[model samples]
Target: MQSKDLLQLAEQFGSPLYVYDAEKIKSQYNRLTKAFSKVEKLRINYAMKALSNVAILELLRDMGSGLDTVSIQEVLLGLHAGYSPEKIFYTPNGVSLEEIEEVNAMGVQINIDNLSILEQFGAKHPNVPVCIRINPHVMAGGNTNISVGHIDSKFGISIHQLPHLVRIVENTKMNIVGIHMHTGSDILDIEVFLYAAEILFDAARNFKNLEFLDFGSGFKVPYKKDDIETDIEELGKKLSKRFNAFCTEYGKELTLIFEPGKFLVSEAGQFLVKVNVIKQTTSTVFAGIDSGFNHLIRPMLYGSQHHIENISNPKGKERFYSVVGYICETDTFANNRRIPEIKEGDILSFRNAGAYCYSMASNYNSRYKPAEVLWLEGQGHLIRAHETFEDLIKNQISLPLPAKV
Candidate 1:
């Protein structure tokens, strides 16, 4: 998308809005699919938690992508987006056994991460197929906050307890269908990820009924210019060769599955916020935007860096400014970042805003959430409307104001 296009979106949808480039999303989906094209049975499940707009989900679904959902609501969102139960993979961590069973009843894939839940669910419904999530104790991701395969991470069942896991499977006679492992997001080292894949392969050897090996995706996309990211082409070439060999050894060509969220939509999304003020302090220049951490919290929550551009003035002189938001708390986006000179009312485009941006938005400070637009085929369609005052109070039960007492 061009800078002028983004500026036009801001003009049409107003500032503090999310605009997703459909073509970028399509290209990303195709890039990932092509990476593993050698695999006989490959499945790409878009992790809907990244950006769960129904339009985006449908776009992926049209391209034959399944969904990787965490919550029951996400699963429902997939269904609402017209995905079949068979196309949805549910891998909930620290959720209730009842919820697992509920999703199981819906005929979606069930992936349990803990021994207790696995045992309980298996003992109750051994006939249903299940997937086991294993923590390989690998830290390939860039940040601990987003990484889940570390030793102390609370995501998957530790690999050290494989014996106990096998025992539970044996005791309950559960049909194991897949093995899954997610080391976390923004994978820093491809070697570490491949090492984790070996762990998953070894775990898969224990189950003869397995139909697939889901190497949970943490593949990184470039966040900024010249930033390091997961080399998908190289990783795919290496892992695909090893995966085919493993399938041969297993005596069955098992499906290769990945659940990628950020890789599919992160670069495709652009968050547009207008500069509300340019404060010149004694020693620092602050460019305050109309939005805050409530809309994009990755910087505050994960210390993520989203390359910001002054789309309104692409050729302006370079200047150092501290980008901030209007939230009451210290909502610092970037500190002393060098970008093009920004003026009041200048539209700032935050790159890599597709994933984990709107999905993580909140209504803190009772502020209205921004609208969402899908830029498809050179047109910007409003996918979601900006929240109204009624939306804020729609769920709250109002009384007679305590009779003025």
Candidate 2:
């Protein structure tokens, strides 16, 4: 979107709003599908946890994308968004067996990660088709907090425990229809992912009833200017060839699945926060904004870098300013960053806010979450309204205090 367009959105939707470009999302989905067009049976499941707006879910559903959900609530949201049970895959971590059984009863595809749950669930419902999440013990991602396939990560069943996993499967007489592995977010190396796929393939050989192999997505998107991203085209070409050969060896064609979140929508999102104050300290110039980590916490939590642009004054002279937030904490978004001159009330657009931005927002400091807008066909549509004081107290029970008790 153009600077003027973003400025208009802020003016209309109010400051500290999330603006998503629908065309950019569609273009990304199309790019992925076209890259892997050679795959006979391919499934792209949109990871709902990254950005779980019902409207966004509907958009992905209309694109023929399946849902990759991690919780029962997300599964229900997907259903509400018009996704069939068959198209929704529920893969939860460290959750209760009851929750698993509940989702299973809902007819969503169940993917078990730990051995205990696998044994318990398989013993109870051996007739139900299930998927197994395996940890390839490969470290792949931008940070330790995001990586899950490492040896010590508590995400999936370790590859070293294959013999035990096979024993449990055999004892329960359960049907394993899929195998999955997720190395976490911001993965830039296709070779590492392919190597992990080899591990998944080896595991798949253990189950004759396998119908799909989910190579969970962490394909990195560019966060800054000239930043390197995952080579999806090359990876697609190489993996498609290898996958077809594997299908031939297995004597059956299985669906190749990917659950991507950031890659699909990161570039499409822009978080617009209006500048509240420009304070000059002894050593630094702080450009405080109306929002805080409560609105966009990737920087404080994951050390993420979201390119900030002065959309209000794009052509102004460049200067260095540290972007902070209104929260009563060290909620720094950027430090000593060079950008167009920013003044009080100037709107700054933070790029790459599409994924994990709104989904991770919190009501810290009792602040109202900003509104969200979807831009489709050159027009802005209000997908979510800004929170009001009533919303903050909507669920609270306001009982009168006992006299001086």
Candidate 3:
């Protein structure tokens, strides 16, 4: 989005807000679909945990993207966004059997990760079709916290345990309709992805009743100016060719599924915060914004880098300033980063803030979370309202007598 548009949003809805460009989301979705258009059937099941605003969900739905959920609440959110039950897939890890049953009752696709849940769910619902999540154990991701499919990770069923999985399905007469595997997020090596896909394909050979193959998404997006990202075009070309060969060998037309989160909306979002103070210390200068980890915690929690721009003074002289938050802790966004000089009251926009930003925010320090706005076709629509003081007390009960305080 342009600086003027962001400034207008800051003025209209106030600062410390999340603004998403809907056009960018649409374009990203199109890029994937167009690349894999040659496949018989391709589905983009967006990981809703990344950014689960109802408006964004609806936008993705309108763009013909399926829903990938990790919890029952996300399944409900997708349903609320007008997605059909068949279009949703619940892929939970280390969850209870009761939760799996609840999701199964919703009539959406159920992907069982662990072997225990798989055995129990299949025994109870033998006739029901299910999907299996496999851990390729490739260990390919940018960060350890984001990586989930290594040998020690507790994400998917181990490839060596295929015998147990086969036994359970055979004994229960459960229909294994699909196969899945996810290495991790922010995957930079395309060869590693190809290797992971080979493992998924090998596992698919065990299930003759399969109709679809889900390669759980971890496609990377550029975080910095020269940082590397997944080459989707090249990946689509290579993986698609191999996938078609597998389909021919299996003698059935199968659907290809991906649960991409970051690749879809990371670049479409901007988190705007107003500079509250400019502290000049003997050692360093600080550009303190009126926000904290309570609003965007990716940098503090995951060491994620977000490109910050002083939108209010885009052309100002450059300087090194540590951008810090107003929270009562060592909450730093970037330390001694060189950017355009920031002044008091200047508005700064944090790029690549779409995925895992607002969805992971908290109301810590008794601070209210900011509002969310969507920029669709050159217009800004208020998707969420900023929290008020009453929100903190919404769930608290008032006591008649406070024990003689």
Candidate 4:
């Protein structure tokens, strides 16, 4: 979207809003699919936890994408967005057996990670088809907090525990239809990912009823100009060839699946917040905004870098300013960053806000969450409205205090 278009959105929908470009999202989805066109059967499941707006879910669903959900609520959201139960893949971590059974009863594909739940669930519903999440023990990704396939990570069943997993599967007489793994986010090395895929393939040999192999996605997208990103085309070419060969060896044409969250929508999103104040300290100039960590916490939580641009004064002289938020705590988006001159009431755009931005927002400090807009075909459509005061107290029970002495 143009800077003028973004400015208009801020004016019409109010500040501290999220604007998503539908064209960008479609381009990304097409890019991934075209890269792997060689694969006979492939499934791209949009990870709903990254950004679970119903409109966004529907948008992806219309693009022939399935839903990769981690919770029952997300599964329900997918259903509400018009996704069939067969297209929804439920892969929860550390959830109760009751929740698993509930989702199973809904007819969505179930992926179990731990051994205990596998045994319990399989023993109860051996007739139900299930998927197994295996930890390849490969350390891939940019940070420890995001990586899950490491040896010590508590995400999936360890590769070393293959014997145990096989034993449980055999004892319960359960059908394993899929094998999956996710190394982490911000993965730049295709070779490391491919090596992990080899480990997953070896584990797949333990199950003869497998219908698909899910190489869980962590394909990194560029955060800033000229930043390095995953080479999906090259990775696709290499993996598709190897996958076809593996299918031949296994004596069946297995489906290749990927569960991608950020790669599909990160570049499509822009978070716009109006500058509220400018304060000059002894050592730094702070450009405080109307929003805070309550809206976008990736920076404070993950040290993420979201390129800030002064859309209000895009051609103005560049200056150094530390972008902070109105949160009561230490909420900093960028420190000593160079951007066009910013002024009070000027709208600033946070790029790469499409994934994990709005989904992670909260009502922290009793602040209202911002609205969300989708830019489709050169027009802005409001997807979520800004919170009102009544929304804050909707579920609260107000009782008169007892008279004090």
Off by over 4 Å in 4: 403-405
lDDT of 4: 0.96
Across 1-405, the per-residue lDDT of candidate 1 in tens digits comes to 899888888998898999999999999889888898889999999999999999999999999999999999999999999999999999998899889988988999999999999999888899999999999999767787888999999999999999999999999999999999999998868899889999999999999999999999988899888999888999889999999999999999999999999999999999999999999999999999999999999999999999999999989999999999999999999999998999999999999999999999999999889999999999999999999999999999967665655
Across residues 163-271, which tens digit of lDDT does each residue of candidate 2 receive?
9999999999998999999998899889999999999999999999999999999999999989999999999999999999999999999999999999999999999
Candidate 3 residue lDDT tens string, 297-344: 999988999999999999999999999999999999999998898989
* Candidate 4 lDDT over residue span 316-354, tens digit each: 999999999999999999999999999999999999999
Q: In angstroms, what RMSD does candidate 2 have relative to the true structure? A: 0.9
If scored against the real structure, what TM-score would every candidate get? 0.98, 0.99, 0.98, 0.99
For all candidates in order, the CA lDDT equals 0.94, 0.95, 0.93, 0.96
Question: What stretches of model 3 exceed 4 Å from their correct place?
Answer: 400-405
Deviation (Å) of 333 in candidate 4: 0.6
Error of 4 at 397 (Å): 1.2
**Which segments of candidate 1 are over 4 A away from where they belong?**
401-405
Task: Compute the lDDT of residue 35 as modeled in candidate 2.
Answer: 89
